[model samples]
Target: MSSTANTTYTTFTGWVDPPTDIRPPLTENFTCSVAVIGGGLAGMATALRLAERGVDTVLLESDFCGHGAGSRNAGQLASAPGGDIQLLNLLYRKGMPAIIRLTENAAGHVESMIEKLGIDCDYEAVGNVFAAVSRGQLGRTRRIAKILRRAGAHVEEGTARELGIPHGFLGGMREIKGGIMNPGKLLRGLRSAVLASTVRVFEQSKVVDIVRGNGGVTVETPGGVILAQKVVLATNAYAGEWDITPKRLSSPMWVTEVETEPISPQRLAALGWTSRSGLITQHNIMENYRLTARNTIVFGVRQIERAASYPLPERHPDPAVVADLAKAFARRFPPLADVAIDRTWGGWIGITSTWLPVAGTVGDDVYYSLACNGHGLAQATYVGTLIADRIATGITPDDLRTIWVDEPKFGHAVPMIMGRLGLRAAWTADRFNDMINGSKRHAREGFATAAGGFTAPA
Candidate 1:
C-alpha cells in the first residue's frame, strides 16, 4: 500500500457521545421468533417492529447499537431518489411511482417515528438540495430535476442565492420532503425505543456463522448461539462477509466526514445560509454539507474507499483522505476557510451495482436487506419496518414488494484495479472542472461567480 493509504487517523464522530447504557451480550443459547443481526438503524427498526407485533425478537450487534453508519453518516434525511435518477427512470420505468413513493414515504415515516416515539433528534423539515459547483454541474442538476419531476417527485429548481446557499454553488434542485438531523441522537433515540420494547438486544455480539436448518436458522456468535425461526440480516455492508449471504450482494465503501468548530450566529447569518438546508454537490461521488445544531458545519465524501476483502477489519479514517476533505471544504466555503476542523470519522456503507436499495429473501427463512446505496438514513429504517411487517403477516406490502427480488443475482463486481482507475478518472474530471471555472481560488471579498461564470449576489 502507498504511504498515504497506510496512514491512519483516529475515529471521532462529531455528532454525540456513545450511549452509556450498554446491553450485555448473550451468554446462553436462546430461541426467538426473529433474530436481527447488526444493530444499526435497520436492525433496530426491524427488532422494534417485530417486538411491537408481539413477536419474539432478539438483536445482536458487534459493537454498541448505532456505532456503525447509523451515527457516522452526514444525517441528511434525503427524500429524493439516490444514485442516477435519470438512469433509474429508464431502468425501472413502470415502477417510477413506487420509487417516488418509497423516497417520499421514507422521509414521512421517519418524521412519524420521531413524533410517535417522542424522540428528539433536532430534525428540520427544511428539505435538501442537489447543488452544483459549476456551470456543467448546474446543467446536470436541471436534467436531474426534470427526471425527478417526470417521476412524480416534488422538486424545485433555483439558484444558490435564491435557495439561501452561502457557498459559490451555481444552482440546484430542491427536494421538498426531507431535511437534516443529528444522526447520533436519532440512532440513540431508536436504540432507547428498541430497548424499552420487549425485544432482547445484545451488544458486542458479533455473529461468526449462520447455518440454515429444516425449519429454523442458527446464528452463532462468539458468546452463544441463537436459534431463530426467522432471521433478518440487517448487516448492510457486512452482509458480504458471511458465506451464506448472496455473493456480490453489495460492495463495502468507506466514506469520511469532518466537522468544524462552532461559528458565531452573526457570522453564520452573514453567509446567507438562512434556510439551514443541507447541500449535496453534483460530483460523481457527491460531497455533502450540513449545519449542525451546535452551529458547526460538517462536510465530506468527495471520494470513497472500497474494502479489498470481506470480513472488513476495524479501520480508521485516513489522515490523507481527511486532508483532502479539508481542502474541498475550504474551496467550497472560502469565507469560512479559516474554520478549524474538529475531527474526522468514517464507516462502511453498502453500494449495489444497480445503485438501487434492495430487500429480498435468501431462502425460506433468511431475509436480507442491503444496499441502500448512500440514502440509507431514511430508506433503511423504512425498509426494515416493511420487512418486519412482511415477516409478521406473510403478506408483502406494495412498498416492500416494489424493492423485493426473488433471485438475488447481481452484476459482477468491478475489478479492484478498474474501480480504482475509474475513481481516479472521476476525480480528475472534477479537478479539471474546478480549474476551468477558476474555483480552486477563493472568491472575492463578498462576491462569487454563478453558473456561466457570471458574478452573482452573495
Candidate 2:
C-alpha cells in the first residue's frame, strides 16, 4: 500500500508514451483564414474541421498536440455535465435541458470520431457511474439522477449489487450515454489525422502576444508570426497568460492520477465488477476509478492542487498525494489492497468562474471557447467542432448558443472553493460521514473487516 516507494513519478501521462513525430516549431511568418492558439484536443478539432471545410487553418502549440489534459484525463466520456448537478439545476434550471443535450451529443461525437478515425484505444461503451461511497452520497445520487432524467438525460439509479459495480459502493446513478477509452490513444489518432490534413500545424510554437489590426489579427511567437483574419483562443487553463483574455476567465487546477500493477483476472472477477464501468464518487471533489484493458486499475483526484500564477510549469504528482490516493484505493478495492502502484502523473485543467463551459468573442474577429471544467475529453472536442462550424459557415448552431455568453466578462471563480483548504474540508467531511455510516452498518449486521489489514470506507 506504500505507493511512493515502488511508483515511477512521471511528468507526462502514463496512458501512452510521448509521440515521436513531433512537428517542428514555427520559424517564419504565415497567413491563414483562422489561427488556433493551442494544440490540445479543442484546437486540433477546430483546425481539423476548418481544413475539412476548405478553410485555411493553422494550429500553434507550446508543445506537441495533446501534451496537456487531452492525454492526461481519467478518460471517462461523461454524459452528464461536470460540477454539481443539483446546483446547476437550482441556478440555471431552464437551461438544464440544453446543457444535458449538449453533453450527451458531445459524448456521441467522440464515439463517432473514434470510429471514423479507426483509433484503437480500447474504447468501451460501458457508461460511467456516479457511484456513492456512503448512504448520504447514495441519496444525493438518486436526487441528481432524477434531475438529469427530467432534463432529458438517459440515467438509471440502482444499488451496487444491481448496478454491477464494486460492493464497496452503495446505490448510485449511471449515465447510459458516455463511456471510457484510452484518451492518449484517441489523442494520438487525432494528431495523426491532423498531420495528414491540409491544416498547418506548428508544434513547440508558443504564442506570446495577440494584437488586433486593420482587418487582421497578428499572433506573435518566439520564432515566427501568424497574420490571420480571425483567431481562436483554445488554451484552456493557460489562457490566463494572455492579457487579451478576459479577467478571471478561469482558474487553473492541478489534478493527479495513478495506475496500479496489473492484477490477475481471477482476482479482478472476485470483486463482482461485472459491468466494468468507470466509477466516480459523489464527493465534493470526486475520486475516479476505472478498470483498464490492461487489467490494472487507474485512479486519482481525491485532492487537487491550485496554480499560484499563470504560465503553469510542468510538474509530477506529489508523493504525499500519491500515498493518500493509494490508501483511498485500498479502502475502495480491498481485494487489491496490496497491489503495487506502477506510476503516477498530473495535469492542468481549467475550472470556470461560473462552473459552466463558455464561448464568445473577446473582440471583432477574435473568438474563444474554454473551461469545460474537467469534462473536456468530450465537451472540448465537441465545442471545438462547433466553433469551427460557426467560423466556417458564418452561422451559430443552437448547441453552440447553449454555452455561448453574450459578454466575455466573468465574475470570481467560485469553484476555487475546491482549492487548498476547501479541498481539505471536503475530504474531512466525507471521512466523517463514512465513519458514521460504517458504525451504523456494523450495528445492524455483525462487524466484518477486509483482508490485508484494510477496511472499506463505508
Candidate 3:
C-alpha cells in the first residue's frame, strides 16, 4: 500500500481502456528455458513461476496482457469448477484429491501472490453463493455441499431470507473461502512482478508453429522465433498449437458480462454478501456474479451450442444482447436495476470436451496447458506452478495423463449453425427463468416444475 508501490501498480502499461493496458510487444526472437505463449493469467503465471525457478523464461502474447478473457471477464474469483461434484469426482477420480486441494490452493495462490509481489489489486476473499434458483436445484445443491464437505471442502447452505434476497432461491450453499476480484488489476500486478524479474515478456507476439526436439522446443512467430528447453502453451481460446492433437483437446467458447455504475452502499448491503466473495448456483446453466469494489455487479453465464461451434465475434458484446442482459440484471437488483451499464463486453475462452482444464505436456519436450473453462484465474496460477515444477524436477507427468487425455473434438456439421439463433435461445432462456422464477406465485422448482421451460419471456 505504499505510494511507490501504488504508482508502480497503477503505472498503466499501455492504453487506459476498461481492460488492462497492453504490455510491450515481443519484437525479436529469444532463447530461454521456458517460453509461455499467451499473455493472460495463465501465460503470466507460467512465466512468473518459471522465473521463480531461476529458469530463463520468455512469454509471448498475441495481444497485450488482460485483453483476453482473463481481464475481459466479470472478475469473480471462484474456487470450484463449473460442473457437479458427482461428475467431477467421477471423471477425475484419480485426480480428485488434486482437484480438492486445487480449489483451496487457488484461493491461497491469489492471496500469496498479492502479498509477496505487493499487488495492489482489490483482492477480497469473500464466500461465494452457490444459490439454488429453484427447489429441485436446492436439493441437488445440498447434496453437492455434503460431498464437498466430506471431501474436506468448506460449503454451507443459506436461504433467501438469510441472504436478504428474493424467495426464488429455496436454498443454496455458500463457500466461505471463495471470493471476487478486479481481474484486470490482478493480471496487471502479476505482469509487473513478471517484468521485475529475469523473465522476458513479448506482447504482440503470435506463435505460428511448434517443433519439438531432443535439446528443446522451438516456437516460430511472425517477427521472431522462440527457442527454449521447454515450451508451455498457456494460450486458451487461441491455443497457437500446430500439433493437431493439442488442437483437438481444446475448443473456443464465448461468454458475456456487464458492469453497472457503482451502486449506493445501502443498495449493495441489500444484496447480502457479508464478505462479498461471489454468488453462483447449482443450476445446470447457472449465473455466478460478484460485487466489485466500485459497487458494480459482475455477472456471467455459460454459452450453449457447445464450444465447437462458438464463433469469435469481431465485436464486443452484441448491442441487443447486452441490453437484455442488463435489463435482466436490473430486474434482479431492483434498487440499482435501473443503473446504467457503463460497459458491456464479451470474451473467448477455451473449453475442453469435458469442460475441465487440460494441462500436461503433449510430448517430452513440448508442454501444453490450456482449456481453462473460466477457472483461469485460479487454475492458471496452479498450472503455471506445475509447468515450473515439471521443468525444475525433470519429472514426466504420467500421473496427470488422464487429466490431459485428448479425445477428438467435433463441431456441428451445419455451416455456422448457431450465430444468433443459439445465443438468443440461451440468453432468453436464462433471463426468462430468472424473471419467471423471480415471481413468488410462479416460483416453485422453476427448473423442474411444468414451468421448467427455458424459453424467454414473450
The most accurate candidate by lDDT is 2
- Name the best candidate (by TM-score): 2
List the candidate 3 regions with Cα displacement exceeding 4 Å.
1-24, 90-95, 161-170, 302-314, 396-458
Clashes of each: 0, 0, 4
After aligning candidate 1 to the native by TM-score, how far in Å is the CA of 166 from where it should be?
1.3
Model 2 sits at a Cα RMSD from the real structure of: 2.7
Our tally of clashes for model 3 stands at: 4
The runs of at least 3 residues in candidate 2 whose Cα sits more than 4 Å from the true structure, single-residue gaps closed, are 445-458
Lowest-lDDT window of 10 residues in candidate 3? 1-10
lDDT of 3 by residue, 31-103 (tens): 7877888777877887887788888888887767666777776666666665556767666666665566666
**Model 1 agreement with the true structure over 1-458: per-residue lDDT tens digits:** 11122222456366888888888888999788999999988899999999999999999998899988889899999998787777788888788888988988989999899889988899999899998887778898999888788878888999877887875677688898989999999999999999889989999899999999956899999889999999999989899888888887678888888877778988888877877889999887788999889988888888888888877877778787777877787777777877777777888888876667889987879999887888999999999999999999999988888889889777664334227677778777877777766643336322444333645432
TM-score of 1: 0.93
Give me the runs in candidate 1 sitting further than 4 Å from their true place. Answer: 1-9, 413-418, 439-454
Scored by lDDT, model 1 comes in at 0.84
TM-score between model 3 and native: 0.82
Worst 10 residues of 2 by lDDT: 448-457
